[model samples]
Target: MQLKNILFTSLLVSALTYSAKAQFVGDALTFSQENNGGTARFKGLGNAKTALGGDISSITGNPAGLGFFRQSDISVTANYLNANNKGTYFGTNTTKNKGRVGIENAGVVFYFPTNEGYHGWQNFNVGISYENTNTFTNNVRYEGVNPNNTIVQRYSDLMENPQNGAWGDKLFKTVLVEESLDPKNGYFPVVGEAVNKNQVSDILTTGYNSRTALAFGANYNNKLYIGGNIGFTAFRYDTSQQFSEGGWTKNRAEILAKNPNSTIADPTHDDYKYVEANYELLDDYSQRTEGSGIDFKIGAIYKPTTDWNIGATITSPTWLTVDDYTSSYIRVDYYDKETDAKPFITKEVLTDPTEDSYRLITPWKFSVGLSKFFSRGLLSADVEYVDYSTNKLRTIGGSNRSREKAWDQDMKDSYKAVVNVRVGGEILLTNTVSARAGFNYFGNPYKNADNKQYSGSLGLGFKLSQNVYMDLAVVHLVNDYKVSPYAIDENHWKSQSPVADIKHQRTNAVLTLGAKF
Candidate 1:
């Protein structure tokens, strides 16, 4: 019954939004997710994960592999990344690139070998690690026209139009009367289309995400290992946008007069007209949320022969609580010298509202891996599976219809099969020294019309000494895609014609250093 409920809940949660913009939710950070050279070298391989020793950072990949660690160790790694973004408006082209440095992982592990153990219990191991799982930083600026007033204001109007219905009509009646005007409305009827002649442009946005997990592992009889992670995650996001519109002076004055005691009003009077003019939508929203969750993994290692080993693990879902805060301001501009109203600054109300509690469930994972030690070298590989359908978006009281819809659409449009294939081996350069190389392929999470992206990785590791060793590895990632946002039609009030094609290329690199004690 519990399993059935889990599946049912997963399906229900996956029924949410799939919009391109909506999928840009919560937190996204790459430095947090990709820290080690080996992990990045092989697109995060797990089956052959046991070959890596020291530290519990690999616990997320496979817990049973912990049995390979025979020494107490500490390791830390950092990552540097470069991101390039490209977009087009109509036929015009634009591009952007940025660089960043981040701490990847730092942790320690302790091993206790059982000298006299019964029931096949070989040893016990405990560890604490901080592994960053995601990093998100991207800037996209495409200028065509400012659709905020035309689209958002129009939607608001539709909600108020009496002819449309009671709900929308009653809500926006005042806004419509104040917006629709002759002569200088700026929105002129050209070829039966209300062309937004007002030059509307400029948008800026930024995002941050971090997750710190406290994890522990135990190996029994060197055959079975179990682990669990208690993770604390924080998400930060901010967006700012500005644009221009003409003849908004009157509407501004009316709003202030109605709300004399409002925070966005003048000190002396509720004079909304003072700010009524061609103004900019100066908006900035930020949310800092924290959540705690638990993820457990159980695994079994079978060694049928001295040189061969096979392992499997099952992972539980992570449950999180997210608290978010948002605020915005609308400022108008009157630059036309011919107008009677002089240029003045108006501060619209400030809104720092907190959302109800929200919940996030990462996908459940199942994996298997194999390793072999031969006369010349060692070889390993891993396979993993996760179900995206079992995720959900919810507030404290319950799930949000809008957010849920967005998540569902994202899942439906996304590719489900995420296959990670990695193969690496060590060649003994000397009795005490070895050279290692690995290759990994992580299938793209998003499917395309042409099916382009599936990131591939390569890395090298070197052994320094018996009790001490250091590894330096570099990884490169490439992701290319074509995505489109929701389209607007001619019937809509000043809507942008459809954007024909959108293309994006992302290249990422990481350098990781590790030391085993």
Candidate 2:
């Protein structure tokens, strides 16, 4: 029993639902799911600023933190980021790494102290800030040998299936086929048997998710602070993939060169010693997305005393409008000893410059935090939850409404809610210097545990002057996941062929400068 034949007998449930809908894969990964980008201080402390309010970043996490301010302040942050991906495929392993720099955060806050006549109000503040929330810059490459079967078997299966029209189907119409072997059924991949084939795939991605926010807040006496913010968000994600497979070719120039006179009909190569191998469908595919949206944030901070604090925040789903473009091409190679055909070459554009527009409703989020204040610093922790399944996809101008509806249902069926936790603390080592550390845990969005992310951070702050400060921070993250290059309903190794186990490591260094007036 051939491997491809066995695949047909056992189609896993996950494979069955892989792409019966509209999108192919990794569609939802484009969203900013863990938007924690902020000032060096915030990131250094695991971004757990909910109840330990007072910094510029706190304005977005919990606007009420803005009300805790008593001075006009401005700050800017820059970050250097590096990512590495290690992949293990059928007995082979590979690794790739990339690095870049960007402005992580910049913002200004204005404060207004209430007059003495205002007994309950302590201060009012307004803020404007920008943050790079998510990054998608990574390079991953994986390769391995597959003696079981080849991609050509997929094309053969497509033709053998009754659903894909008759012998004169679209795929059958291609010139790369041997119809004589099965005139009634379909065509064969090669004139002879195939063996010793291997597959290599590469995936490259780059882009970002950013947000600009305008916020307002006020302090009530010495106990409560409340605020709201309006945020504008934008995202861009670009990715490309290249996959190649090679193996059996009697006329494979290598073999043909040795046996210059051997015909395609020659099976055992009585005249030739070794024939060069051949591969089909060396292909490249690319996709890009540009989008923008608006979202709202409201939050409150309660301080019963100077020693204890509690905070809560709510964020509405972002309504994003996006434009997607994709292109792809494939090259197939073959050689025929008969009909005087030599190294047949043909290229086809599988996808043109296709454009698509759609709306995405991101999930709503809720967060809560607690803090304990000391004479020198504070310790804080936060917990957040968002139902990723609520992420929805709608049709454009009612185009393909029914089909999109089904896709949305699939999104809900495949996704679930996630819980993220963060903890951090700052300690004033001296009157002019401070130290900070934090840890964050992000639950996996997938049903399996292989995709979760964990981050740890360390930082330092220097009080340059009474009104000037500088902060430095470093964060490290690790992710373990699986990437599938392609998943047809039935690639005998459909369960394994395109799937690669990937281990990813990311590091970031941020420096922030701030001024208080």
Candidate 3:
């Protein structure tokens, strides 16, 4: 084989190994962040904006909203959130109680007039801004006996009783030797044994994402609006596992039959027992899954009268190409299963790890919002829909798991169009201060899955100057879901692991500081 071919093969193998260890689904790359008062207004109406203005964060929801801006604007925001996650496997508890924290968005925009002085067109506006769509961190614990009890016990029993025709007994014969025997045995004899018991494990994951977008738009005779944005996204993720994995026979039984410091009279002191070994595998997978993509948005606001306005927008999906890297390490040790006693031992460590890369296609989204003006205030609403079923994971190299995940029934299931409804209005309490409130409802994305969510919000905005204003919003989110595994144990012929149900509640808060010129 050529040297280059061998190197390429090794690299592919490493990539596949890394991909196998990072297997997981639904790390949703979509935004879960809501503008402080977005949910409240969203609930009252929905994102049906005939006139888009005020909040810059709303640009992603309705770029036409930018057409409402009379001048250039910039805004920075921060948010905090708490989540509860749970999982159940075949009526058995698998994982539960997960939480996380993260940052949402910060960016600026410059709105340009036609540059030719808005002659033929009513108004020409172009701008730039940044936003965050997804933030996550979760930890789960699964215990209550390793599900493969039958197979494991068989391996253990064979080791304990060498005469038993089991795989462990066969393995014991292959490695045992005469030179390893103790003086008491007439002939040098090496012994081996196996044991089986419960195996408990813990899994953890941490992730975050933020994006920078350059946006531009225009308004024609205050009646029609159109715009587009090119966004660059940054993504980070890490996953790890801790498990008890060393009880297979051959090795454990030998430790029991050996009375290294004792004579035949003290044989009773040396006994055979199952060895419980625990090891922690740490995988630090950190990389930038970045790609630049363009999204086009066109909207129109038709005003039949001065007080009422109707609007709508169609947003193209942002197609992105992602690249990622990962690394891992493992350590192991043994203890007496029954007595909880640690035998004199040293830890085994594996530091070098394999690395790999892969790609993912997140789905496209669609939304629309509308608003109406009254004597003292104005009311607005918006609606959004997304097709998550089209999302997919692509394997770039040597892994079979990716192939398996591709053909897996769970991955094949189609997700429903998730819906978001929102309603909001502003009341002028005074010349410079305005009050706002809104509500929003988001339908679950899973097709036959459970986990529905809703939110409510309120806020206050004060204009410091003609081109500057500060707004503070308080939002509350009520989220609930059902988490169940597709299958419980592989050996169950007729008993497939039924999806068990689990529910969770989450809450978050957001604040935005902005300026318009």
Candidate 4:
């Protein structure tokens, strides 16, 4: 295939294509994004631990905060998530829900205090942590009548493009589409015109990204805290889509009437004999991806006054090696009425599972934060920046340099840098009770699209005993975006194609149990 055609197909058909090595701009973005998932206290605080210290979440948020530990500590967190997606396609709306429960995080910090008056260093701390940074569990379903085009038209268009080669041969083999009698006309759907086909699709995705880090921190003269961590990340993503279209109305007579100058094939041929009134097509595609990466982060927090803390951190790009596996199949069912006894015929085609591997470098991230301490409460805020355009992909064993370069260029052309903001506060409601609230805003990274995400959270902390405590947090997130099932060149279909607008919402409940020694 031509490089341009390959790029176009990879981007437009990311969800539908059966290509095993289809790493595109979307995959780059998915791996770069992070979620505020950690201990309930930190999650409730909008993950604003950059400036505030004394929490295990700091191992991932800002290792420098580990210096605030006055004693050895250990904590474990559990989470429950519920995702809801509302999709609108071709004037029809559908809602789907998915739920999952898992362990969110666990960590331990060991504090070593220096001898009093031993230089300016007050203490050194070491920490080990495991955190689930992102979850991909979701489900979406939408159906509607399409009046303009069908996926068959897209296949027909592809058949005309020489660069696409014989990829559409399977469509012809399955009898879903047929080659035109005239070579110049290319291919056409056997079921006829592209209009008024009832289309429905159900998609399900499941996976997660997690990080394990070994961190170290130090406190200097009770004012300056510095820390760094070496982090390893694990990633897995799986998605499956089942699409079906029906309501076909076509007959040999209708074809002859529409094209007066056309030549009709044999009357008994499958293409000419069947009325196609009850034709239906089913397309199923699924993909699984697994990968691992490594990154480094260093940060510092300075306290110039007893009430004010300033913090900053810089994280190096993550170097990821990914492997993808994909498989797909198509099925067509129709009935022939010309026989003495009408019979239903089914034709199916399947592709062998394929696998590919590659490497990706995510963009660097920088963040700064400020926190203010109060007699009964504290408030903190943070700002982060990342340039999505900097993401790059490399083919394994240096095998497809041109393709890799094209993907890299596409990332730069389709993405941009954006700033994220987070704010949160904790109030001591009673001697043994605390209340926390937070808000987070993730900026849009697309160059020509709006896909920002927002999250809000509320939490409570209980001092069950002097040595043990419990924290509970609830978070709500919302994101809205659009997806195209298929794409056609403007020359083939001048009008806009059908698209699905999806509004996704997620609710998370987290509980953390901790003890200090």
Candidate 5:
């Protein structure tokens, strides 16, 4: 039965090697999503700026809101972020934290009142702004014991497959897996069964997605506002992962006891001399991705009454040209009890990094909002829709038809459309002071996973003096997901694979300083 399964997996691995360069669906989703980030006021209001205008953030949200500017305005925003992750693997929990401080946003808008009367065109506004739209800074750690299987089984399977070529030769040289005496039986793992082996993994990631936009807006009779913007986005992402497994011994007596009828029980058997103890393996992988893209947005705001505003906006897909580089290293250690007391060690390193360049098209976004004005403050809400399945990847400057089709199929199978919601309200406590609170819900985009995120915020605004003002906001967000360290064919293994549950939390504090002239 074992031999039959080995042959089956060999064929499968052989077929997969042809499309090794295909991009993961998760990568597509990562590039398609953005955070609600801008000025402190915008963050304080849950980023529901589709309808409520007059802020520099409008250059990215609803350009039409730029028309609300009655004077030249300029502002700068800074932010501090703290992120924590708790990962649970096989019932064992581990935690890690990270922090960073940086400039979040900066922009300026100039307002020009048209010479035409109020009955016709009221005003025109132009603005330029830069914003950090998404942050990928995080750290995660998970450790546990697997009693069912070891990663060696995966390497052993690949070693037996001729289609994978020499990819697993290092495992053989390191004696992590040995070829069967009977060639028909294929390769066998030297580490034996899972049996109380400890496993640990640490992952770190850092990056940011930023955008700069030039926008224009117009006001009609002081009742309607419309605007548009062309934006350029820059992206960078880097991640490193280290995984280690150890704390087990290979005993010939124990192996024979577990399978008394096996060939190893016979002293004359060629495999009987395979006695080892205290086995360990360390694997490291790192990858870096850099890219840039361009997109366009248009929006409008309508006032049905003095206290009501209705707004909507549509964003085009961002077309990105991405480049990726990756490298890997592995080390193995073990004591050859029968040969010497000292441990035997072997290492494998890929000195040259593999590079791939491609094109990615993100999903389009549609949003609608409503704002109700009170005597002193206002309440606003926005709903946004995005179809993640619309994301696509293609080969750059060449054609890889099969790979492109496979990537397209994977996107459709892995993602779905989702709706995001934001609600916020602000009230004036005094003529010069105001308070704000908001909530945001981002829906899950995966077709087979629960990855919803929730956020809440609080803010304070101070009118220091006429043209000079300051705003402060704090937002807390939570997200949870599951990750698998490696994949194994369930049918080929007796034990089920392990999965890690990760809970991520982040807090952001932002301060905006600005003046209106």
Candidate 6:
């Protein structure tokens, strides 16, 4: 390869707006956080456990609830996760579904049975747990033709306004195109019309958010429960994408009809009689993010009667530092205008990898719950509110302070507060078996849109022997959003780019085995 072409390959890779991120611009807040991760019973009960205690998983939310346990127990949950993401670009629609396995929750709780009659302190409990809270494994494919514009303009604009703020125009000339100055457009460069072409993209996303926690709590007079948890959280996220645009733009059938004597005889751009050349773009980009953090939680439950209980909890924002890495490859079918044909393939892999470190402060949340027990059944409900807008991003260096502040301000402007609600009920089916049902509502984080998620859950529990049991639960989630195949960032904002609509759905099934001593 020529030296200039090699430089072009490297510069163009850096010039594109693509980044290696665990969190994309649209799903960052939602993807970085975890959902409630616990036992099958906890999930089966809609995770409305603030006031309903007695399960080992409850320690994750409010350690005080663990006070309800009178026996020491251990549990492990296995899960099956399936996600289907659909997208529509222009008028074509495509869907991709992916399936995988995960361990959602596993933990143990120890209860010190107390006979202390003095101060009504019934018992003391301590627990430690590890749970997988959120997942990012998914796939989406969208394909269509964009008739209004070409990525050539995007390349030209990048050359005009370089990212480093110097010699961008000079560097642009080396790798991308031979630019001819135009009065109105500044630099005019076109391999061809890039119309009547094909556009396609396939992306795979994968990751997980998990946490390990230690909790302690005590029960007072069998009427009150108080507990707290010290937690450490970590996550890994990655996205790999393959996108292509353009092919043969014009056909010969329509050309010969216009000029009967004109000798354009075939559909391929190889015909020398054709006035314009043809080109294609095939590119791949992939990025990964890994992070670890810490946080704290405190909660309490008050039971005035044996059958009724009320509870509330406060969760502190997590302080996290994240590391990101990214790399890319590009291939172009260069069109020779003089010959009116594609001469050769220009392919280059940007082997240079980029890395960045940043700090993040997640949102603080508050929750309240109410539970009622009956002779044959029980009902529980919880309400939780989080301010998504409170999420902030900061670069590590003093010189990057302004960049971090700008990003933080942008997050505040783009996001809003959301309230999530969970409700569940249990119906006794037999002496040793019970049936459970629940519902949950997660408010949309985007303030300008009405996108929300609703989930329904069903579960069953059985007691196989005196100290052993099993629980099975299933939950379904659905939501809708939009994405784009490519952005016209250099010339026009993404809002001006073609919009692709998407609807995503997932199902999680979990089974928990437990033994009590």
- Name the candidate that leads on TM-score: 4
Residue-level lDDT tens digits of model 5 in 1-517: 1221110101112123532433345577887899877999989998989999989899999999999999989999999999999989878999999999998999999999999975888899999999999999989888998787787777666666676555666456665665665555466566766688788878888999999999999999878999999999999988787888875545666544444444544578754544555667887777788999999999999999989999999999999999877776667766555355656654463334568888999999999999999999999999999999989998886588888888888888778899999999999999999999999999888776657589999999999999999999999999887766654555666655567778899999999999999
Which runs of model 5 end up more than 4 angstroms from their true locations?
Answer: 1-23, 157-162, 179-187, 253-274, 336-342, 349-352
lDDT of each structure? 0.46, 0.73, 0.47, 0.81, 0.81, 0.73
**lDDT string, candidate 1, 1-517, tens digits:** 1111110001001112221123223231111122222233233232147433333555555555555677777766666666665656555566767667876566666777777566566666666666656555555444454333243343343333344343333323222223233323312211112433233333344554555655556666555555555555555544444433343433334444444333323545543333433433332333334455555666666666768877676767666665544433334333424355665544342323434456666667677778887896677776766555445555566646776677556655543556556666655666654455555555544343332433434344445555545444444444444322222223434453323123444444444444555
Off by over 4 Å in 6: 1-31, 164-180, 187-194, 248-275, 334-343, 347-351, 397-399, 448-450, 489-496
lDDT of 2 at 503: 85
RMSD of each: 9.6, 6.3, 10.7, 3.9, 4.8, 7.3
Cα lDDT of model 2 overall?
A: 0.73
Model 4: per-residue lDDT, tens digit, 1-517? 1112111213223323332223446687888888867899988888888898899999998999999998999999999999999989888999999999999999999999998675698899999999999999999887888887777767677667564454566556655565655665567665655568888888888999999999999999889999999999999999887888875646666555444333333365554534454667887888788999999999999999999999999999999998877777778777544332433777776666767788889999999999999999999999999999999888888899888888878887778899999999999999999999999999888876657589999999999898798999999999887766666654545545567778899999999999999
- Better TM-score candidate (2, 3): 2
Least lDDT summed over 10 consecutive residues: which range in candidate 3? 3-12
Q: Which parts of model 2 have CA positions greater than 4 angstroms off?
A: 1-25, 155-194, 249-277, 334-349, 488-498
lDDT-best of 4 and 6 = 4
* Deviation from native of the Cα of residue 338 in model 1, angstroms: 13
lDDT of 6 by residue, 271-301 (tens): 4333344566777777787888999999999
TM-scores, one per candidate: 0.66, 0.84, 0.65, 0.92, 0.90, 0.85
Each candidate: how many clashes? 40, 4, 38, 0, 0, 2
Model 4 misplaced stretches (Cα beyond 4 Å): 1-22, 180-185, 192-194, 253-265, 336-343
Better of 2 and 4 by TM-score: 4
Q: How much is 369 displaced in model 6, in angstroms?
A: 1.2
